[model samples]
Each structure stands twice: as C-alpha cells, then as structure tokens.
Target chain A: MDQITLYTWIGFSVFLVLMLVVGYLSSKKMKSIRDFATGGGTLGPYVLGFSFAATYLSAATFLGYPGWSYEWGLSNLWLFLAIIAGGPIGVLMVAKKVRKLNNGQKSLSLPDWLGDFYKSDILRVGTGLILLFNIFYIAAQFVAGAKIFEYLLGMSYTSGLLLIALIVVIYVYAGGALADIYTDAVQAFIMAIAGIGIFISGIVIFWKGGISDTFAGISHELAAQNENLVAVFNPESLHFYSIGAVIGAIVIQWAFASAPHLFNKVLGLKNEQDLGKMIATYVVVAALSVLVLFGGLYSRAALGDTASAADLALMDYIIWAFPAIVVALFGVVILAAAMSTTDGIFVSISTVFANDIFLKFLVKRNIVKVSDEKAEKIAFQISRLTVPFIGLLALLIVIRPPEYMGDVMWIGISGIAAGTMGPILQAVYAKRKAPARAAELSMFVGLGSYLFLYFTGIIPSTMSAGAVSVFIGIATINIASWILRSASSSEMGAAEEGGS
Target chain B: INEMLSIWLYGFIIALIIIGFSLWKWYF
Candidate 1:
C-alpha cells in the first residue's frame, strides 16, 4: 500500500510476466530430455555467456558479499579480485574442451560428461550425488530473496521465500534450460546496470573531490571506527586474516569455476568457435558485476555503528541512498540476481538427477528397463518434476536460514569444488585417460578432507579448507594413477620373462 | 593510508594484467 511497496509490486509483476512468456515459448521447443537439459546445444555466445556470469554472480555477489565488505572492509576485495581473475581462467581452461567432448556424446549434464568421458557409471552417479549439495546453495539464495522481499515490500520472510520458490519452480519446470538461459541473460543485464548504479551511488554519496580523495575519505572514516577495518589483511577477520588465507580464497574460487551450473554453460554453446566470444562477454560482465562490492564500504563509512546486519548492509544502504522509485526498481534487480542463480541451479540439479542418476544409472543398468523412447520420455518428465521437489527441499532449509547467507552457500560450493575440480580438470586436459579408480579416490579424498578440515576448524574457513582439499585430490589422482600404471607394467614384464 | 591505497591499486593492476594475458592467450 506504501509507495515503495506499490512500485515494487508493479516492477516485479512485469518481470514475472516477461519471464513466464519466455518460459512458455521455450516449452514448445523441448522435444527430448537433452533439449530440456542443455537447450538442445544451440544457444548463442551472448546468451550462454550472460547466463554463465549471472548464475555465478547470484545474490551472494550483490547481497551477501557487500555485507562482507561492510563487516570486514577492504580485505574482502581480495576475494573479489580472486573471482575476477580465477573465473575466466577456469572457463578458459575447460569450456572449449567441455564443448568438444559433449559434442561427440551429446551429454546433457556435467555428471553425464564426466561419466561418459571416464566410461564409469559409478563416477557419473557419484558426481550426481555430490552435486545435490547445491540444494544448500539454492536454499541460501532463497534466504537472500526473502531478505530483500522482507526489506522492500515488508513481506514476512516465509511469504517471500514461498513466493520466490513458486515463481522459479513454475518457470523452470515449464521451459527447462532454454528458459533459464534466456531469462538469466536478461537478469545479467539488469544486474550489470544495478552493479554500476551501486558503485556510482557510493561515489555520489561520498565524493570529496575526486576518486582518490573519495577512497581516502572513506578509508579514514572506516579506520576511525576500527583501524583493523582498513587493513589489507585484517588479523581479526576469519576469511582474509593471512596471506595463506588470501591465496586459499583464490584457489577455491578457481575451483568453483568448475561447479556444475557454471561449467555446464559450455554445453549450450552452438560450437567451439563461439567459445572465445562467450568467454569474452562473461569476463566483461563479471568484471562489471563485482563493482557492487564498493557499496559495502560506502555503507560502512556512512552508517558507522548504525549499519544493519551484514547481509542487510547493501539493502539498507540502497534504501537510505535512493528515492522510492529507484528503491522499487532496485528491488526488482535484486530479485533478478537471486532468481537468476536459483533457476540455473534448479536446471542443473534436475538434469543431474534425471540424466545421470535415473536414465544413465537405472535404465542403462536394467534396474528400470524400458524401451529407449519410453525411457527418454520418463527421464524428461522426471527432470521437469525435479524442479518443485528440490525447491521444496531448499524451502525447508530457508525456513530456518543461517546467519550468513554467503557462508552457508559456500558450504555447498566448497564441497562441490573440492570434489569435482581435480577430476574435471584432469578429464579435460590429461593426454592419457586418468584411471577411473584414481578419479573416484580423488573425489572421496577431496570431499572427505574438506569435511574434516571444515568441521575440525583446522583450516578455520570453508574456502581455505576447500582449497587444501582440492590440492589433496589432484595429488591423490596423479599418485594413484602412476602407481597403478607402474604396477601393471611390472606385472606384464614379469609374465613375459617367465614365458621366455 | 598510502600503503593501503598502493596495495589496492597494485592488486587491481596485477589482476587486470593476468586477466588480459589470459584473454589474449586463450580467448583472442
């Protein structure tokens, strides 16, 4: 009934209508499970590029990360720098190879690509199971969306969560990956605009004379509040306390580039030729998107002790800095950021379940035998059905959301990155086939070591723990492969000598 | 203050250079 709420409703309604229209159009194009999963491998460079960047940016980038900047100060920028450099590099290392590999097999999902490449059903199913951790990441997005709705529209957290879940589930179920990609591209554009707006608003609020003066003034204000706040490596901070921790952040972010939802964007590109253009677009957009982090430092300087909770810092700043109409429009952009990632996650999780677990594991093994046509139909239906099922699971977690949305999301991200990064990198780049046993061992080591380090507080931060685990995994695979190869060769030599 | 500012500036400069080199080598 208030002006802000009224405008927000109007803006959000328009966004929802546009998204549903795209979903409806895309639904008509889904003739097979592959079409539902990977947009029939026909998306253009810009669409896939934007979708990849948008999915990576998410509410964490806009809402959660700004809060980190507000809480921890300039030290948080190291993580941002890591993402800027690591993301494109990760994509460059994998995208063209992934696209070429998938072209031959027409694999519909990340797990499917790995499983087929390694020729192991166990690897496919194991990776599929590991990716289910994305449920936690999705729940974190819901918490973010609910927080924005609670702040902007004065809706209860529960109502906001339910509304976001309902909207995302309906569209993704109807249109699948095609709809998710197109909407994600649009969302990425809006997020880019909002990112610029956030950065400029910080300058507009705190312009002393020029850019240098503005930054110095802000730094002085923060140092006045707490000298540790402006430190490049704040000793009190958990995430960026030491040089080791900063390097850990970079390594983990590089590993995150291999996450299923982000990496699988390569599968939708029309061909390898489009890859350079796609990666170029993604790098530019991602570079722009992270500019929103400056809002954190700005809010910290402006609000001082009165700043809201860490996750709420950016939202509170937006409310305080802008007028009602701009606030309302920003509300839409924030929702786009949250939904963009959530929908991509939904598509990725569903594809893993239907394609990797159900079709490949069960039908291929005769555990659920059926004619190929019937099996495809069942898998497609199952994939569509999975949207609401996982949405409901994630909704349950959001009902009792964690204290830090960003940290909670990283719990899942760290696990997936640690487990998959080693095997995936090796699969894409290795000249000789990595032993399937080595891949499996590396996954367990990566995941197990990450859990041990995280829970025991040895590493003390999820990103650091995940980074160490990734190295352990890569090392495990190489050692195990070398040992196995040597042993087999020795056995062959011994048999030849005995025969002579 | 100068130290902090320099670190920030240099951090970004190094990151941009790495990204630029990567783009040229792999993407361009």
Candidate 2:
C-alpha cells in the first residue's frame, strides 16, 4: 500500500525469483546425496571456506549481535570472542580427525559420522534426538528472518515467513549442496559489504553529534536513563560476568563449536590439505566478528534512548536512521545470512533424524559399515522430504515466539549444551569409552537437569547453565567409568598372579 | 667417524653441563 512497503516487497520478490532460478539449476546436477549435502566434497578452498563461515553465522550475527552489544555495552563483546574461539578451534582440532574417519566418503551429515564412531545403532538414535534439538534452533532462525521482513516491509509475518521459506527450500532442495555452497559464497560477500556499510553509517551518525550531546538530547524527556545506552564499560555493573562471565564464555564457546551440525562442515571439506586454508580463513572471519559487535554499539550510541527493543534496533537504524538504498541493502544482507544458515541447520537436522534414527532402527538394522555413496544418497533424500516437514512444524511453534530470536536461541542452546555436550566431549577426550549404562545415565541426567533448570527458571539466563549441567553429567559418567575400570583391572591382576 | 662424533658429543655435553651448573647456582 505504502511506497516503502511496495519497494520492500518488490525487492524481496525479485531476490526470491533469482534464488529460485539458481536453486532450479542446482537441482539439475544433484545425482547423489553427497552432491546434495556436502557439495560432493569437491567445493574449492574459497567456496568451502566462506560457505562454512556463512553456515555458522545467521540473522543472529546480523540482527542479534548488535542488539546484544547495544544492551550490554562493551561487555557483550566477550560473548562474540567466545563464539570466534569456537569456530577456529573446532576447525583446527577436529578437521583432521573427522577427515581420517570419514576418509573418501561422501557423507552428507553429522549423524553419519557419529553412527560410525560408537559402532552402535543406539548411539546414532540418541544423536538424532540431539539433531532434533538443533532443528528447533534452526526453525527459530527461519521464523526470525520472516519476522524481520514483516516488520521492515509491513507484510504479514506469516506471508513473509512462507515467502522466504519457499524460496530457500526450493533453492536448497533443487540445487542440494551445489546451490547452498554457491549462494552461501555470494551471501558471505553481501554480508561483509552490508556490515561495513551499516557500520560506517552508524559512525557518521555519531560524528554528527557525539555521545555527550546525544545523551543530552534524550536526558531531558527520559527519566531513569537506561545505563547501557553508551559504549563505555563499567566494572561495578552486573552487565558483564564479573568473574562468572569469563568462565561462562569459555565453556559455552567450546561447546558451540563442537556442536555436531557446526563441526560436520569439516566433513564437507575438499581435502585434508584444505584444512590449513580453512583454519586460516576462520581466523580472518573471527576478527570480522568484531565488526558486528562495534556496529551494534555504534548504532546504540546513535539512537540513544529511542532504541527500546534491542532485537529491532539495528533494523530500525537501517530503515529510519539511514537512506532508502542502505535500508534495502541491509534487508538483502540479512536475508542472505539467515537463509544460508537456516538451510544448513535444516539439512543437518533432517539428515541426522533420517540416517541416524530412522534408517538405523527401521530400515537397515544390520548394515554395519556402509560406504559414503550409499549413506550420503539415502540420508540426503530423507533430509529433502523431512526438512520441509520440520520447517512447517517450526512455523507452527513460532506463531507466538517465546521472546526475541536471540533469547529463544540461547535457551535452546542451553538445553542442547546440557544434554549432548557432556557425554560427547567426554567420549572424545578421555581416551576411554564410557560404559554403555553410564553413558545412557549421564545423558538422562544432563538432559533432565537442563530442562528442569530452564523450565523452572532456577538458573539465571545470563550464564550458560545448560553447558555447566553438561559438564556435571560428563563428570558423573567418568567417575562411574573410573570406579568400574579400577575394580575390573585389580581383579584381573590378582587372578593373573594366582595363576602364575 | 661415528666414534669421533660420539666423542665430540660427549665433550660438548661436558662443557654444556659446566655452563648449566654454573648458571643454575647463579640464578638461584
């Protein structure tokens, strides 16, 4: 109806049409599952590098990061640092090991790797549950993107969600990994450009009137000024962890990077040698993370008290605080970042559910050592169908979202960090296998504790209470394992001496 | 040649050991 609305819809529609064409072309070449999920393991260093980066980032980075930085001041940068740590470390530490294990296999998903690791159908099934949790998180991202479009363009949220969803799914389904990779490369470029442009505009706003005067303008009308309206940090404030924030940041980032969906990107790398480049790329991207942090802080300084809701603050700045063209560019960048990430998570969740849970239990119970071609193709087909189903389910839940996109996501992360990270991390690091019973018990305890804490609101939402619970669960499993191992070893030693 | 190298290695080790003992006491 309105000029701005008309332009916004037109821009979004044109973008969607181009994406659909690309997706259609991508699907034509999708002969197998590897081609669907991992870009056929043939993605070059550059595409692979950016695709991986884009997959980890989302609207959360674009919209959520600045909102968070705006609210918490410079202290919020610590969380960004924690996130940056997770990406590079996961790539460096896990890449070689994952490649060696998945060796020459065209596996499409994380569950495929986990299924191989435990050599147990049951473990794969449990991993599927974890993947489902990941799906909830991904679905939220999709909903967030739609919400952004609806608010900015004055379209109905439902319509915007469906419009974006249709375009993303069509492209991803048809093009499979090819379309996802190519588009992600393009999106990454757009994201960088948008970040630089918006950030510069935010700076210019501050230059027009520095923080001292901006506060003076707002200080008259507003009583009890929001303490976080500035870029400065204060030690006495509870805005940062004090001591807990530092420890919490370290623990959470370690778990986030090690998340199966994020780490599975390693399996998609072109070669073992390419890992060096991947790690190098991660370092650069990690530094770029500071850009989002500064952007949010700068925007906060520009808007002052007028920036009420943190989530929409960045978007509001782009729309009202800048020119029409910058606003359009911002929308494009957010859509690009959000779509690539949402698709990756969607594909991952479906693949894990299909291959790890359904295929292992229902379809092929006795198949022990399936190769990449068989596994990847079968898993990918399952994911293609299931992703839309999962997307629809997410759509239903997001109708009245819990709060902002970042809030719901953090809670979901807490639930996952509590449930899966403990046992998985223990399994990886201990050089000793958890007893079957112990692993099962620890998972139950960790998952149950996290849910209890989240639902009851016993744990402050500030710290990663879920990751902490995971650590407790892991400790329980290791202690049990230690006791059992010691008793068995001593008994064997005594028996050998008697026999001699 | 292997034996000669081994003897040289022993001498270098003795001189290094003298330096290490001297440095350790001085630093402490």
Using DockQ as the measure, the top candidate is 1
- Per-prediction count of colliding residue pairs? 0, 5
> In model 2, what lDDT does residue B20 have?
38
* CAPRI quality level assigned to candidate 1 from its DockQ score: medium
In the predicted model 1, the residue pairs found to clash are none
What are the interface RMSDs of all the models?
2.3, 27.6
DockQ of the candidate models in sequence = 0.52, 0.01
Per-candidate TM-score against the hidden true structure = 0.90, 0.78
Q: Model 1, which residues run further than 4 Å from truth? A: A25-47, A96-103, A176-178, A259-274, A371-374, A494-500
A1-500, model 2: which lDDT tens digit per residue?
25556666677678767766655654565446435645435566666666666765577657776777666655565555556554455555555555554554444554554455545555557656765666556656766677667766877777877876776676556544333566666666566666666656655555536754543433221223454332233353333444564556557666666654454556655555566666555545544544665566665555654664676777766766766656665676677666667776776677566666756665576454566567667666787788678777776666664345665566666666766665566555656665555665666788788777667766555245665677777787778767766677797774221110
- For candidate 2, give fnat to 2 decimals: 0.00
| True-structure RMSD, every candidate | 3.8, 11.6
TM-score of chain B of each: 0.76, 0.55
Please, what are the lDDT tens digits per residue for candidate 1 over residues A106-154? 6656687778777888889989999988998988888888887888789
